[model samples]
Target: MQLDDALHAAFRREATGLEGIDVAVYEKYDRDPCEPIIGLGPREAPIGFFGRDPGEQEVRWGEPFIGAGGQKVREGLYRAIHGAALPDFEASREVGRLAFWANTVPYKPLGNKAWPMAVKRRFQPLMAAVLVDHWQGRELITLGREAFLWFGINQSRETRQALDAFWKRDDRFETHHDTPLQLENGHAATFRLYPLPHPSPLNQTWYRRFPDLLAARLESLDAARRLG
Candidate 1:
C-alpha cells in the first residue's frame, strides 16, 4: 500500500478503539466537515518536527502546521536550506519538502486548547508509529515544551534525568544531542531532539531568536543527513 493510505488506515483502526470524553471530540472534529491533520513529507526524511496540535487552519487544510507559527518555521527552514526567505502562506508542497511535520495531537481542538492527558495518552501510540515505524526519522525538532515533555513523561527514568538537565540549560545536550527513548508503542530508538521555543508571536521572549535557532538546527540536520 502507499505510505499515506496505509497510515490513514492505521489511524482509522486506532481511532475505532479510542474511548473517553475526548473520543467524542476527536470524532466530531476529525471527520466529515473536518479532516484529520496527518503529517506531511516522505517517510525516508531524516528530520521530523513535532508541534502541540493543529489549529482551525490546519484542520481545514489537512496539514499539520499552516498557521502563523508554522509560517515562521517554514521561513526559517527555507532560509537555512536555500539561504532565502520564503513567501508567506506558500503551499504545503513547497514548505513540507524541507522535512516531515507532525503534531503530538493529530486532531484539532475546539478552541486550540491544550489536549488533556487522556487525549495525549490515547494518541501517543499512533504518534510513535508515524514518527518511528512509518517515517524512520532520526531527528526530531519539537516546537514547544508540551510537545517534548510528553516524551520525557513516557520515557525511562534515565531519559527523564537527561530531559531535566536539558531543561536547566545543561551543556550536555549540546555535546550529545541524541538521546535514547522508548515510544508509547514500546519501540526503542535513539533520536536527536532539538527543542525550541514556540514561534508564536505571543511568545515574545524567543520570538526574535527562534529563526536563528531553527536555521542552526536545520543546518545541523542537513549535515547529519549528508553524513548518513
Candidate 2:
C-alpha cells in the first residue's frame, strides 16, 4: 500500500478501537472520525502548531483548529502582521505560509474530553510520521500540556521537570526552551517546542494571555526565518 493509504488504514484501525469516540455521534454530526485533519499547506513548513485533538468544529470543517480558540490564533497571526485584525481575515491554505497546524490525536472524541491513553499510544507512530517524516517541521508551538508532552519528552527526570515547569508556567524556567525531539520512527531532529496553555475559554487565565503569547512566538519565528 502507498504511505498515505497505509496511514489511513492505521487511523481506521485505531478509530475502530477507540471506546471514547461514538461512531453514531460522529454520524450525527456528519463528521468522519477516521479522517485525519492534516494541514492544507506544504508538508514541510518550518513552523507548526500542535493541538491536543480536533474539536467538533474542526471535525465538521475538515480542518484542525477552526473553533473559537482557532479564531483567536488567526487573529493573533494578523496582529503579529498588522498589529490589528484584518477586516476579512480568515485561516486557509495560505496560513501555512507561516506555519502548519496539526494535532497530537487527529480524531475527535465524543465530547471534547481527553483521549484515552490507549488511543494516544495506538496513534503515536502515525502522528510522528505526520510531523517528522511528512512535514519535517522545525519549530512547534504546542497548544496545551498534553500537546507539549506528546513529542516524546518524558524519558528523563530532567525532561519531565522541564515539561512540568512548562505546564505550571514557571518563570524561572522560561529561559530554557526547545527539545531535541526524536519521533518513534527514529527521525531525530531539533524542534523548538513552545508550550502554551490551551486557548479555550475554559482556561480563563491563559485565554486572555494567549493572543499576546502567540503573537510573540510568531514574531520570534518570523525573525528567525529572516535571519536564516
Error of 2 at 2 (Å): 12
Q: Write one digit per residue (lDDT tens) for candidate 2, span 136-215.
A: 56777778778887765424476667666666766511332666655655676667786677999999877888877777
Runs in model 2 lying further than 4 Å from the true structure: 1-3, 22-25, 88-98, 153-162, 165-169, 172-176, 223-228
TM-scores of all candidate predictions against the true structure:
0.80, 0.83
Q: Candidate 2's error at 153, in angstroms?
A: 6.5
Compared with the true structure, the alpha-carbon lDDT of candidate 2 equals 0.68
Question: Which candidate achieves the best TM-score against the true structure?
Answer: 2
The sequence of per-residue lDDT tens digits that candidate 1 reaches over residues 159-214 is 87777777667432233256776665577777788888888898898899888777
Instruction: Give the Å error, residue 74, model 2.
Output: 1.5
